[model samples]
Target chain A: MKKSWSHESKEYKIYVVLCLILGLAIAAAGLYALQKLLVPKYMRGVVEGSMIAEYYESEVPHEVLFLGDCEVYENISTVALYRDYGISSYIRGSAQQLTWQSYYLLEDTLRYETPEVVVFNVLALKYGEPQSESYNRMTLDGMRWSRSKWDAINASMTEGEHMADYLFPLLRYHSRWDELRSTDFEYAFSRDRVTVNGYYMRCDISPEGEFPAPMPLADYTLPETSMDYLTRMVELCRENDIELILIKAPTLYPYWYEEWDAQVRAFAQEYNVPYINYINLRDNIGLDMSVDTYDAGLHLNLTGAEKFADYIGQYLVNHYELTDFRDVADVARAWEDDILFYDELRDAQNAELAEYGELRSWGANAIEN
Target chain B: MNKKILSVMMASVMALSIAACASEDEDTAPVVLSGGQTAESAEGSGAQEAGETAAASADAYVFTYNGIEIRMNAPANGIIEALGDGYTYFEAPSCAYEGMDKVYTYNSIVVRSYTMDGEDYIAAVELKDDTVATAEGIRIGSTEDEVRAAYGEDGQPGTAGIEYTLGDSFISFIFENGKVVAITYTAIVG
Candidate 1:
């Protein structure tokens, strides 16, 4: 008689246990592989999604950490800071990164390293509540699992977002299976570095054009939520003995209202934090918007970012005691790698421009979405 | 035997999940058709001259000025041309990338256009003064009751005003002392 499988048999029991373990391992591996395949590669156009994760790969310490929106990420060049002033800095910036998100990111950064100075751009203060989900994902998705990431997700989720979606991004991005491309498979295990210490480079030039008149607003007051986060950021930095410098980058599209600037200035005064509105200091910074801006007057091109970095680096070195990383051998070697990456990115962008008259690989024209 | 069945079932479930995604992949596949071209550039090149007109015919929140139908989310060039050059223009660059957010102010009304992808679409039309009114006859000076009578009570009321959402756009009215102080037709951009 063919003996039926018996739980009483030790051999049979061992086989069953092994089978169960194998099944679980397979299930877990399958899900992980699926996740790797479905998630956006962010290689082509919208590379901002990859910026947050790149911070973990930094082997060198940074003395300056920048936080905020594209105004910080796209407007300032970190490599230029390193090259010119030997000021080691990193930009923990994302597209339209909100104030609370910045606060949470600052918290996350302190977990690993505390920079001497934290520079925060003030333009994101205009947004009071949670904005778009896509923008939120671009800001929050690359963050590694931590208490700060958890809080950031809780604070940043839009109406339709759920905790589970962020927890298993596979669940949120499962529908992206159809959009999978060659790059998705190529980068499934690892992704190419998108930013140079968080600097998004654009070499193409579009002169500043005539902008529309600023629309009158119903309310001029900055949101209490943003103000509270700013206060929390100040307190957090104060606790860590870190200097928080507030700045408004010199971009002339979103119309930095006098009322808004006045409020930020008042907050800075009350908190005794230094505030710089670069719009007022455009000439002093030697910014020529006509040739400097790549997208009309929205953001600075590579040349403009280098100029802004030089100006900010001067202020940083003058005001705060930042490390001259060039003198340190190990740190200098790491930064030299970064400088090479920056140069390569600039060359690639410039090459494309020379061929296509515009950046076909990196700019608005290259956006996959 | 039961243990083997359970393990197989667990493995099968995960396998099914993977298979299901593969099966639905074709339906959701993204098709990249062409390169970027601004609406103005397309119009100038005569490749998409009728595209905005086609979009205009779709159901939209419209603010008609001098019989020229200005539809929300439709290209702004046609309406601007029909409305003539009598209006003042102001433009601001978008936050993310290329393109501009444009505002055209005529004597009585203001038309705002936003950029998506690389094209300019009418984002909002504001009746700045009492001189202009919606096609439904609701003007800046219309009473709240008059607006309610025309738009129905389905409007989402807030501290600022009441907004009636229609498809992808909304008609908002700012009320002061039970009277409509401002009126706007706006597209909802996520």
Candidate 2:
């Protein structure tokens, strides 16, 4: 007669418990693999998503922290800033980063290290609400776990986005199963850094073109929600003893209105903070839009970014008591390594430009789906 | 029984996963337009089908100028041709997305178009001056009371003036000191 397994037997209970534990471990491993394969590897084409996460890998403490959207990230060269004025700076900027996102990013940065100066670009203030799920992922996914990240995600979710999706990106991008490329698998475990201290490089230039006339709005007031967040940003800077400077990057399109400018000016006056509108200082900064901008007038190219860095670095040194890192040994050594990377990147881009006349590897054409 | 319970749990997980990632594509709320006519209300008011397509064709709001039918969410090539080639054109490339947003300016009107799937669709039409008027004869410099009289109370009120939606399009009028300063027809483009 075959013996039936007894439920009360010690061996049976132990075997069942072991099986349960093994099953859970296997399930967790499978989910992790799925997540690694599904999440976007922003290695090429639309590499803006990869910029935020790369901030953690920075070795040296930055005395200046730049916060905003593409304007700061694509328009300022940190390596150039170091080279010109011996200033250590990092831009915590992402694609279309909204106002609240900037505030939260500042909050997150304070957790790791506090910079003496925090320069914020004001273009993102026009957005009152979350803009896109993709943009939210770019700004939030790379942020390390903290209350700041949690609050940022909660504030930035659009109509259909769930906290679970942000928690397990596999939940949001599981539809990307069929769209997986070789980069997804290759970068599943590790990622290549795409920015030089938060500066996205574009070597090829598209000369400035005539922009559309600014359309009149029903109401010119910046969204109240955005303004509130801006107020919070100011208060946060005060608490951290960080000097905050507001800037309007010199992009011709996405037209900055005079009415909006007046409001920001008034706010700056009220707060006793300095506001610099680069549009007015374009000529002084020596930016010839014809050669300086890459993608028409939306952003500056490598040449333009370097000039901007030189100009801003001069301003920063003149105004603040900043440390000239070139005098410091360890910091200088680290910056030397960064300079090498920057030179190599510029050389590679220039080579591609010389070969194709247009960037087939970096700009709009290099976008991988 | 154990196998059955496990099957049920797996099915629930699959269902919950899909529910969590629900698609955000469809926008089916009824659009209310000027003169108190809605896509829903127009059905009872003897509106006829205007296009071959079934969705929103019958009730899509169109702005007419210089004997041309300018429509939101419709191809702008034919309308541009009808209005002639004397337009000041400007193009802005999308930041992270594909395609360019193109603007064409005529004498009294400005037409803006956006590209999707490699095709240009009319995104907005702005009446640049008092020379241009809506089909209901509302133009720049018209009083806010005139707008209330023509569009009735069904229009949505904003900080500037009232906005009326018809299908995938909306007409917004900007008023300052009880007079209309600007008028625009826009499409709710994805």
Candidate 3:
């Protein structure tokens, strides 16, 4: 009778252990599924928001890293760098990404692999403090969990954002359930690449138009906080033995003021960094504002981006001792797949333009009802 | 034995609670579209269908001089065609203004258009040279005193320009070299 009672107790203990493990497994899986569903799948529309996150999925190492807001991502063609110069690069960018955000992104990139040169667009330096929460989310939401990401969140959070909300995005995106579409479920596990090595392409051409004169600012000096980040970015690159290049993308408007340009030039000179204001070099680079720009003179379409990339690629080859991977069989084989993807995206965008008289499958309008 | 059953029941309840909250919160939150329309109301009346129909017939829509009769959100192409084909169309970058899409240039006159819910609307018209004048005879070269005499003494003066408010529209005259370099008429939309 005593032996039988002991056996029964042991059986009960084993049953409880099995049940606990099963419950915990189910809970963890459910949480992960919920998190995936709540996050924005940039596959369909507003794909610029997805550019930063897409960098992590790349298995190939980059020789160059371009970091900035829309100006860098929309204006540089990484594929062109690889195709024309055999220089692999990635642009870690998002919409209205601030200067501090760029610093943390560099820190994040160093963790994976250090690039020889880091090109930063200086336009974001105009903003000293955090901008809108939506823009912040577009830049930050795609980052994988790391101390760099945590610091980015802390530095970039606006008035109403909470760090806890970023840690568990379910709290911030709980309301997105009402806006869920079929794409949300389809891309819950994985997403189609939205950019070609961090280069967003637009094939359509819109001639540059008259822009409003920039309103006079009370203070023309660059914001101290933004300048501080610029300093930190320079320091971080120096520590990593990486060369940092400061550039102002030749975007015609949001008017890069002369005062602003002078400040950036002085900063670059002080840091002994290579600073190139593409706005001044547009004529030399052979960029035609009439055809090269997609939206008025604000951003370069694919043609202009390619031209800019070609010009910069030559500079990289001439100045830096980057390897020409064209002769290397393995590198060429890897790039072959990327080139195919780039051509496919270009053809798709052109087809969309022909069918709709405008691009409907890309940009912010790509999200379906 | 009871403890085991209780633990299983508690875990199940927690999971159910989270799922329930997701759906319930979604139901209570409002869905707003890009064009500032409620999703439910926009779908019911079909904003796109109505916009297409309106765009097709925008030739009949006209803004009388000194009046706000311009259709607030009709396609710019149809309206430009209605006015005349001599106008040059310039596609403005989407980032040019908060919501501007394109601009049509006619002689010295420029018309700025906005897009909402994939449909275009006339937002503002400006005269940058001596080729056009307002209904009140205020031309681009009109002086500040002349503007006040033509429109009214009830005007606001700022550092860069001066503005005179009409019913649902306002006229702004930009000052450069101490003279009016441009005059713009803008429609107010909610």
Candidate 4:
């Protein structure tokens, strides 16, 4: 009887192992199916696509890169920097990139093409309320990149929560995925020969004595992670013999009340990086600081960015002694090639502008040369 | 005797499972159709201009069919039709992650429409050697910097004026006006 019982137990063990193996296999298959359903929404027509399409397909390239929310994407045009002052930079940023997510993206993509300068946009202060609809890309993470690209993906994520964005994307931004796919998504953005000028972020606005005043962050207290990323970015720049510069793009909508300006100001001072908050620079930057809003005063148009880039460009040339690449014929010619995408991009933007005048948001501007 | 019975039962169960899996595999099989893009291309690679659309060769496929370039690319996954002058198309994306070759062929299909037609499509397109347009399609409202802080720097007015090039249909901001009075949208085709 004892031997019989032992044999029965062995039989059960064999059955359990088989069942476990089968379950794992099925789960893996299901996961692959989910990925197939979701990934294409963002990465369609990746091959032989446009120039900017090619840039995003690869890792970050510029020395000091910009990564954050769409505020950066819509606000900053790296090409503007290249054209205005010949600052060879790239926008590694998009809309709604949370501090947690972009920090990892920077870390992930940094190793491939590290930048000496890093620009980040602050958001969590005003819209800390998770339900407060975000005006930018809000993906938590990405997944299933190929073997060679796997390192970039991992580096981008760092220690950030790998959360549902990868495994359960349908839960967070399914509608966004569906809606965005309607347009041409570079699907895979490469950075070769890219003309990117990344910059822009704004403070919220208040009516006359509405909140008493625009209380900017006295001392901007950034997430330890953002600060750490900044530090790492600075160090990386040092290692590469690159100079790091920080700019806080101005906003009509001040995210931080003037009270907190101390924290942000002190932090900028402590880091020894130039902090040009357009709040104070409205007059300084020569911007009217009164009438540049299109979306209930949420963001700026090309008019504002040109002035801002020009201001920053002059500063770089005067103080940093940066070269004006376009002064030479070949350099100007190179810059012209970057505009090859402007037309395609314009078509894409035309669609958005048609949806809502002045409030047209930023998105993929082209699908071709 | 009991051990023998148990082993035989277990073996029988395992056999039944294997048979069930086999049947399931046979139950649901996918059929792949060689849509017009690939098949037509190769066969027509040598055939020149079927109707002036211009095919490289007999096996080449032209992006035609009422001047719509949306669904012809992915004939199977989604459908596209016109909504008045504007047309919209939806399709599964064709993405190649890093070195992977179309591990993902189709999914996340979307439909888009524009108010413009073929002439607009062509006109908007800044072909090689074409001039850019800075002043053609730009309009400006008030120079509300209050709006600038809220929206973004992309559309705010500056000392620089809008720059357009009819030489190539190009548009750039030139900071001529005290504010950004002009902005331009270009083209989409390669």
lDDT of 2 by residue, A81-107 (tens): 999999999999998899999999999
Flag regions of model 1 displaced more than 4 Å: A1-5, B1-12, B15-63, B68-108, B114-122, B126-190
Candidate 2 residue-wise lDDT, B60-167, digit = tens: 668777766777887655566666888898876555544557799989999998765455678899999999899878999999989878877888776667788888
TM-score-better candidate, 3 vs 4: 3
Candidate 4 chain A, poorest ten consecutive residues by summed lDDT? A209-218
Candidate 4 lDDT by residue in tens digits, B66-182: 343321112211122121223222111111111100111111211221111111111121111112121222223324342244334564232233322222223333222343333
Q: What is the lDDT of residue A52 in candidate 3?
A: 85
Candidate 3 deviant stretches above 4 angstroms? A1-14, B2-9, B12-190
- Local accuracy of candidate 4 as per-residue lDDT tens digits, A230-324: 56655655666666665556654434555345645676688676656666676676655344432333455455555666776676667664456
The CA lDDT of each predicted structure is 0.81, 0.81, 0.74, 0.39
lDDT of 2 at A107: 95
Question: Which of the numbered candidates is closest to the native, going by highest lDDT?
Answer: 1
Candidate 1 lDDT, B1-190, residue by residue in tens: 6755685858766675765455332332111211243544335322243345446555667777886777787766666767778988776544343346678989888899876555667888888888888878998788999999998988887655788877678888888898888787888765
Measured against the true structure, the TM-scores of the candidates, in listed sequence, are 0.81, 0.86, 0.72, 0.45
TM-score-best of 1 and 3? 1
Worst 10 residues of 3 chain A by lDDT: A212-221
Regions more than 4 Å wrong, model 4: A1-34, A39-55, A58-64, A122-236, A289-291, A321-334, A343-369, B1-190
Candidate closer to the true structure by TM-score (higher is better), 1 or 4:
1
